[model samples]
Target: MARKKASPEDKIIDAALKLALAQGWRDLALADIAAEAKIGLPELAHIFHSKADILAAFERRIDAEVLAAAETEGIESESPRDRLFDVLMLRFDALGPRKPALKRIALDLAGDPMGALSLIRPALQSLGWMLEAAGIDSSGLRGAIRVRGLALVWAAAFRVWLNDGEDQARTMAELDKRLRQAEEWKDALSRLRTRKTDDAAA
Candidate 1:
């Protein structure tokens, strides 16, 4: 089957990523992105308000790609951990082509704490979708914990991925290790909650 045509939003995202790879993200202006995308500034503004919005749109695009791939593969019988592992690796695969651009953005954003802080909410929201894709419940207090835990896991793995070779062995190892640690932490938290409930009853 033929691939679907890229939408205007996708075109702008592609242009921004391409520009980020060539010139770095921080110094590139919105006008640069518009010219790169072959669209006028008014059209670009209609789809995206700012560069941050473009980045967020790119993140959402990756999320959708991962989810679509997960749906096609059908890992329903796998354990939650295994499913989550697969889902996250799929996400990495989608991101692999743009690693250089992402690395530049990561380094530039590191100095901008508020910029980094602004992304946390969208990151958590994406992680929540990841949890659901893995057939895990991403709701309520336990879901909140899982989202936060996954955030740490993603951060640790992302740091490794930026420096990882094409084989991605180190990145995969880090992701696996972090997921195991998160599982242990989740179990410990569950036990603590149980203990507190028992004490309350007593």
Candidate 2:
């Protein structure tokens, strides 16, 4: 029995993560990652142009994992909110082992507004996948609104998760609470819109 070899992209991302964890991303260089990954500079460069590219790839990897898990677990029977909860919880599970590095990245980005801003597109992309995994439509104006709202909710819950300690009980509680609030608001807005429609009809 032998361990399977990691792909070149995986190797580069792993090395970047390891280096980022050991020595913050700000101080990490492509040369260091190439060395850690045991690949030549050309090989590493072919896979990733910069640390940001590696990080983006890492985010996409996590999104793929969460989406795959959702398909395997089968969310067909669950309510929309429950499906979302399960999908997001699966995301945490995928990220569990990399918590330290993620936390460090979060902290570092907090001090760099531009860096944090750069993540907005990726964050929205991830939320779109999350919604789709939950059997929600992420299309059109309504879909855009849902994506933005969930992004905000997830961001707030993520902060709770970063400090959630080993058990993750707080993270679960916070996510549930936030989702509940969002659901309630959605219901209220629905009713309001219905009343407005009725008035317009009258």
All candidates' lDDT scores?
0.90, 0.88
Best by TM-score: 1
In the predicted model 2, the residue pairs found to clash are none
Clashing residue pairs for model 1: none
Task: List TM-score per model, in order.
Answer: 0.94, 0.92
User: In candidate 1, how many Å is residue 114 off?
Assistant: 2.2
The number of clashing residue pairs in each candidate reads 0, 0
Per-residue lDDT tens digits of candidate 1, residues 25-76? 7788999999999999999999999888898898899999999999998766
Model 2 spans > 4 angstroms off: none
Worst lDDT 10-window in candidate 2: 70-79
Which structure among the candidates has the greatest lDDT?
A: 1
